[model samples]
Target: MSPSKVSTIAWDSFHNTVDGKPRGGKEKHRGVNPATGEELWEVPIANQQDVDDAVVSAQKAFESWSQVPMEKRKEQITKFKEHYLNYVDEMTDLLCEETGKPRQVAEMETKGVVGFIDFHLSLTLPEEREEDHEKVMLTRYTPLGVVGAICPWNFPIILSLGKVIPALLTGNTVIIKPSPYTPYTTLKVVELAQEIFAPGVVQAVGGDDKLGPMLTTHPNIQKISFTGSIATGKKVMAAAASTLKRVTLELGGNDASIVLPDVDIKKVAPELVMGAFQNSGQVCVATKRIYIHQDIYDEMLKEMVEFTKTIKTGAPGSNALLGPIQNKMQYEKVQTFFADSKAKGYKFAVGAPEVEQGKGYFIQPTIIDNPPNDSRIIQEEPFGPIVPTQPWTDEEEVIRRANNTNAGLGACVWGKDVERAERIGKRLQAGSVFVNSWEKPTPQAIFGGHKESGIGGEWGKEGIKAYCNAHVLHTYKQK
Candidate 1:
């Protein structure tokens, strides 16, 4: 679709939903199409009052919803899943316009939500265990009432559902607060939930800045699940501490991929490029640094630069393999790294700084060669499509360098020698390690970050349990 066509499409004014009904606010903010830099729609800027109403709605619903049988909850989720699948096409277009990601990426995210829902359904809650004949202990996992979910702009649909599905299945009511940059698709997701679920079971509110703090600090909210930057994660954590609310944070990462001398340069170069530049490297787990064995560094660099030249970047819904950077603030952040690289005289193996004529957050995919490990591009999470590669000779030295970062979300090892790769991958200080692949997270596997990367995990049996509070009931016979 053309930019004008996308801009002129009838857009809905997203507002807060409390008790399954739409409520508007006096203040409002316009949604921008990042691809064209055009205003798409105006959504309500939720104030403290809006946050109060949303939490109250969730609190009221939790009392009754938490008591419903697990089977009935599964049925509701199944019905919602069917509805979501039927509306995938429409949702994909909305996602593309709001986030400026390719249609394929949007569809991939839409399809991934079903796996999370099904995983929650397949689980059986913990049961009572007989410690002995006379003494019995029952382990009960109870829901935390009135959960508040704050999702980031990138991958809004999946991340929002990532919190909503598990929290709802575990019998907690939720109020989702989506980032102002990309709130349309998430609001649509919550709108669909209203049709299948009872009032206040699942709700959403959109805002620029004030709404988040209100939701996080609200006394009525018992748990907070947040996915965003570490700086913001810290703020959320501090705010939730006042009420001692349960918090699960999935934050930033500066992931690395180690390439040993045994691998084929042509085979892994393409995969590395995709891992580094997917979503314009806006992903929290996208590979940020690459370490190649010094013996094969030249060969791998040549192959990677050649492969990167073949890929295209442009607006969404086009033949472009990669889209714009999603917003102006991020666009500026990526530029700082480029400027620093130029000032420090870093070697650019593939891309250089350039200016686009029109209004869009566009940046060419960049690859730097052999920058110092302490450079800003290597140390900080750019959250954009610029990656640096360095050469290392000794395995011990490389592993130490890889583990040097405070952000340890994901890492990868690429080589033909499985034993060596496994050994090296195990030593990396990351939450998830891949043998020959990168950024591959499944619903059944546990995913999270170590150190400053994140606070809690998601997308496994443990992920479902993150929303629950364990209550142990003990029985003792008269002695």
Candidate 2:
């Protein structure tokens, strides 16, 4: 398993289909490889009619699938997982090509997709226990009719699985509208899923977001789960309101990574670099804001800079450690953060806006020093690789500033003192936090945000509950 060995699986082309009829959306957009500036493929931008067709398909499937026994459904899903697991190479390559993530990151996420399927299997098949006596009782979990999922581009395969699998496990049918920027990869995965699950039970549709409202507000859909920017997430929520649909949003984050004075920077630096910019900083939980104790700030910055400089950035299959921005808009957005920060008087400690020679949509791994709290780079979620590092004199003050943002998705604390890290982790408003390690969405753990970051989580037993509607049953003894 040499790191240099390039791995790519040849995946079949994805076509837009409805009821086994191959169809194309009203318009089409080109999916480009940001690393090479090459046009990789074109994805059809679905129209209102296309959304209607998909939703109808799902709604129709729910009628029959919802009646299927849970054990039988689990058996079918297990076979789906088997198929999905066998094609890990294809899924990994598709993700790398579409999202511009390095091969290792792609493989990691491919593993995540498999793990998500396994997680749903674990949660959906809770042990059936006998309750009080003469009156037979069964606590049942049923799906919310038709589930609509709007997936984000970063970690598309894994995030899609997080939402789609849970909905399916609960006996609900789903229609996924993948982020057009990275739709093909997920579509291919779903195409494989169609083998075990019926065509309508699990489906994917790609299109311009303008059509999303139609899916959200459709009369048949009972719940909506979305993973993307806060702005877009709000839009989805507003639209779902028309149908009074149950919704779960996994949105934007300006997650802060607090570096306590006694923390080990040598160990922390590499993790922060990966956490912040693993996918060119396109991650929602990317460590955007870093607060460090003044005593160790300078030394930590040196280590962070040296570590960031060592990462190689290039195409997906390259021997590089980092990859290009997923798209041009993201590249431009990263540049704007740089231009605005400098105008507001921030110093660059590691890299600059000007990318290396011949790099395509690739910004150097940047670390800004002591930017003002009010600055856009600090106050707003960067959603890119640009991170602002500031010095905090007091522990309480650091927690206050970290929780100041409307977002509360994730946070990280680094300190050699375990007790101090735990104390700080408790005060943070984020849904998830890691002490001495950066944020990662594990299948067994819960993942979501607080406030504008998101409404509910999307993994673990709690995550499965989001897709199900609970009913209470009471029995009266005969007199």
Candidate 3:
């Protein structure tokens, strides 16, 4: 059979095409392009039955898949990795079209996913680690059966792949529910996965928020990994409690970037913007807030503004530096903060009050100066291209302000002196800190949040542990 492009899938394996079953899965929702407000696609809303079916499928596939040896699982993943890389360009275009992200940003997201598939396969399912029989001590990691993965809209393909692929690599069958806004690209991934794995080994259910709770509460789902808001993360946790399911929650972040007195924001402003507004500030780890030292506050602010002026804000295909804000609600929420901040008394050093281009949700690369710390824009997770910055005198005070929020995802402190930056970075409350530079996610490195930002890590050896269970082999010796 030829590999035909499929953007949707049925809840049951009985149909190779779309499900013709009655419309009991809630209501059909239309996904729109944030850039043009055009109807991109309509995804079937999965109700309780759909979620139940997904869980049952995953659980069934898990029995046989979990029995596969680690080495064999690794080999299958290796083949899937090769096939995934060949399809990166296709995936990139789908991302751009669906998410309205910059072409380059979409490419980077797809590239991360491609690398993630290869990385997890190479890291997790290795042949052997020196077998030890002396102490009756042995460590074998096995899959947690069915994994119900709830992914966010931002970097849909990468985040979904980042979670599901690793779980699949470690022998866990997954039922992924991508955020309704950006399910198209992820559905494409599921289509590709079906060719390599069993029918229910890696399945996707695209629907509203309701499907998530169903999957989380399902008796068969052994693990639940979610990436979204703090409130929702809590709810997911609470729902999974009854089932006693292992849960991993990657939540919100209001990350900070500090520029020490000696460092030049002019030299680092581009990097800061890249880190802050890469996906139009829809990133969980984006530097949403900046706390610059008083000595260089004006200089850094000026440089940031100048650098911001050079950035391109347009539709996805333009290869612009920035893209749409991902969804309608997010765009309006961001616009409200900008409007409210300016109305109350804050200043926009750069960026317009409104969106620059098509009706699609887009925000100018905005920089707000000295907004009140108690203001909603400063205290809350903006999750947009808006960055609120202020000056501080004391190092301790800076750390205090940075850690004021409930989020402790990722933070950065830049300075000419690496030691000084490191000292400050260590003090900040975050999972990962960057001294002088922001480090992108690497396969060998662990990436997750502290506090409310996330419960578990992804993209490393530790990430593999998140998907597996340790077993001890005991052998009796007869003398």
Candidate 4:
């Protein structure tokens, strides 16, 4: 297929919802098209009163919703999936307009919603009763009441659904609070569900960061599933502590990638570029740091640099491989990384060190050449279109260097020597380690953080159990 051209005409306005209905908030906020700095549409900003109403509705609905039985709940979720598919095209446009994601990337996130639902639908809730040793024992996993699904601006649709689907499939109601910058798609997506799910079974509220604390600390909320940066995640954890709510935080990742001396530079260079710059390197698992063996460091970095040149960086709707930063705050944050690199006089192997802000938040993809191990770019999560490359001679030392940071969400190793790659991968301190390729999280495998990356698993069987409170029953058997 030819590359998608930069394009967008117009779209209808969206709204926040409560009790499966579109509801207005106390204030109004305009959604900006990050690619053009244009105000796309206005959305209602949920206030304290709005959050209280949504949570109360969700809590009220949970009484019946949680008891609806897993199979019945799945039926409603299946219906929600159908609704999502029908409106996915529209969601894609809103996603791109609001987040400045390339057309293909936006579509991928929009469609990924179904994949999450299908996987959750296929999963079975644990309900078992066993009798052994003249005793009766039973085990069950049940919902933990209303869940607060707070989403980040990056990859809003899939990440939001990743939290919402499991919560609903496990028979828990949800109140979604999307990032203020990227509210249109998430709010509209939940609006689609209102028709399929019962009143208050699912709802979405829109607001700035203030709504996050409101939802997190609300007593009626039994759980908080947040996906964002580490500093904000710490605040979420602290807020949840007020009510002692079950918190699942998928925070920032300073993920690392290791390339051994034996790998094919031609074959792996493109993958390295994607690993580092996918979604303009804003992904939680997007490789923040790369360690290439000294034997092949120059050649590998050269190939990776050339591949990055082939990546088109511009507005969404074009054949551009990357779009602009989603919001001003994050754009400025990425700019600071560039500023620090320039101040310290670090070598930039790919694009320039800094960008001039104009109408859009565009930052051309860049690869920072082998900065010091303790450099700011190496130790921090930029969440932008810049990556740091390092050279290593000894495997053991490289492994130690890779695992030195507190942020360990994902890591990867690439080499033809399967045994050697797996050996080094095992020692890497991360929640998920990829052997020959960067791991794309599926519903089948569990993905999460190791140190400060996150608190709980997000996919697979464990993901299903996360929303539930495990219960055990003991009965005396006739002897």
State the C-alpha lDDT per candidate.
0.87, 0.80, 0.78, 0.87
* lDDT tens digits, residue span 1-479, model 1: 10111232234657678789887889888778888889878888888877888878888899999999988888888888887776777888898899888777777887778777788789757776768868889899999898999999988998899888888889999999998999898888887777789999999988988788898889989999999999999999999999999999889999999999999889999999999999889999999999999999999989889999998887777868888888888888888999999889999899985544477788889999999988999999999999999999988999999999889899999999999999999999999998999788777877888998888887788887888999899998778
Cα misplacement distance, residue 2 of candidate 2 (Å): 31
- In the range 1-479, model 2's lDDT, one tens digit per residue, is 11121233235456565543456665778787777777877767777777788878887888999889877788888887777777777677777778778889788889866667876787754434455655545555667898888888877888888888778778898888888778887777676666567768987777775867878888888988999889988998998888799999999999999998887778887887788886778888889898989998888888888999898877877877778888788777778888897777779898874545465677778989898889988899877778888999988899999999999999999889999999999999999999888888687888999989999887888788788887545454465
- Supply candidate 1's per-residue lDDT for 465: 81
RMSD versus native structure for model 3: 3.7
Clashes of 4: 4
* Candidate 2 residue pairs in clash (backbone atoms < 3 Å): 46-207
Per-candidate TM-scores read 0.96, 0.93, 0.91, 0.96
lDDT (tens digit, per residue) of candidate 4 on 269-378: 99988998899888999999999999999999999998899989888767888999888888899999899999999999988866876889899999999899889999
Measured over all alpha carbons after superposition, the RMSD of each candidate to the real structure, in angstroms, is 3.8, 4.1, 3.7, 4.0
Per-residue lDDT for 295 in model 3? 89
* CA lDDT for candidate 1: 0.87
Q: Which ten residues in a row have the lowest lDDT in candidate 1?
A: 1-10
Candidate 2 CA-lDDT value: 0.80
Better of 1 and 3 by lDDT: 1
lDDT over C-alpha atoms for residue 34 of model 2: 72
